[model samples]
Target: MNTAWIYLILAGLCEIGWAFGLKYSEGFSKLWPSVITVVVMILSFVLLAQAMKTLPLGTAYASWTGIGAVGTAILGIVLLGEPRDAVRLICIGLIIAGVLGLKFLAKE
Candidate 1:
């Protein structure tokens, strides 16, 4: 329930949104989506910086990137009809486990 943790979670959510926006941008052909994606991505980084004010930079960055990758991949599979093979699922699970392990380990 730490404020830094909340900020990190918000940053992760923003990353997911930014990723979706980027996909919708279609090489920036869609002006509004592309602009929104850029804005959201910047906001996400800003939030990450805020979180890093208290959290260790390496830990915060690793968690952020790990969660972002997992979330975006899951979103792609669910929303975009991307493949969900066993190997892909296992990889995603490993990413989640690694992120969780990092979080727990950092607490002590």
Candidate 2:
């Protein structure tokens, strides 16, 4: 695996962190959560930029956002008491499949 991919994956995870942080921040009213949210968001974008240096922009952005969306959705269902319906779950699965397809088709 390429170092850029590692960075991209980490960035995606960081995006999940920030997304949760934003939810917990209550519109940035809280101090620590808001701070962490900003920090992690910056880190995520920086890592994504680093990844874009090596990978195609379209491929990298798609993978990055796909990972973040899937992870955040799952976490919302598990950690945040979000609803888990069949259609929603299936859509998430399709997003995962799309991410995998993009990865398989991408040139590295």
Candidate 3:
């Protein structure tokens, strides 16, 4: 795998962490989670920018956000007790497909 792809994946993971941090932060009322959220958000953006140095902007961004969205949605359902509807699950599958398509077809 390309270094940029690794960075992009790391960026996506960090994005997930940061998003969860936001939820855990409770509207920034809690200090620790809020601070962690800021740190993770910065790391995610930094990795994303690094990935953009090599990857196509549109493809990289779409993949990054796709990963974040899918991961977050799963976490929401599993960890946060969000609803698990059929339509939402199917939409998530489509997103996964699109992300996989971009990953396989995209050229470095």
TM values, all candidates: 0.94, 0.95, 0.95
> Which candidate number maximizes lDDT?
3
Clashing pairs in 2: none
lDDT of 1 by residue, 1-108 (tens): 688878998898899999899889998899999999999999999999998998888878988988899999999999889999999999999989987887787662
lDDT of 3 by residue, 36-88 (tens): 99999999999999999989999899999999999999999999899899999
Runs in model 1 deviating more than 4 A are none
> What local lDDT score does residue 37 receive in model 3, on the 0 to 100 scale?
99
**lDDT computed for candidate 1:** 0.90
Clashes of 3: 0
Cα error, candidate 3, residue 21 (Å): 0.6
Off by over 4 Å in 3: none
Tens-place lDDT per residue, model 2, 2-42, is 88889899999999999999999999999999999999999
Q: Give the residue spans of candidate 2 off by over 4 A.
A: none
Q: Residue 2 in candidate 2 has what lDDT?
A: 85
The local lDDT score (0 to 100) that residue 13 gets in candidate 1 is 88
lDDT of each: 0.90, 0.93, 0.95
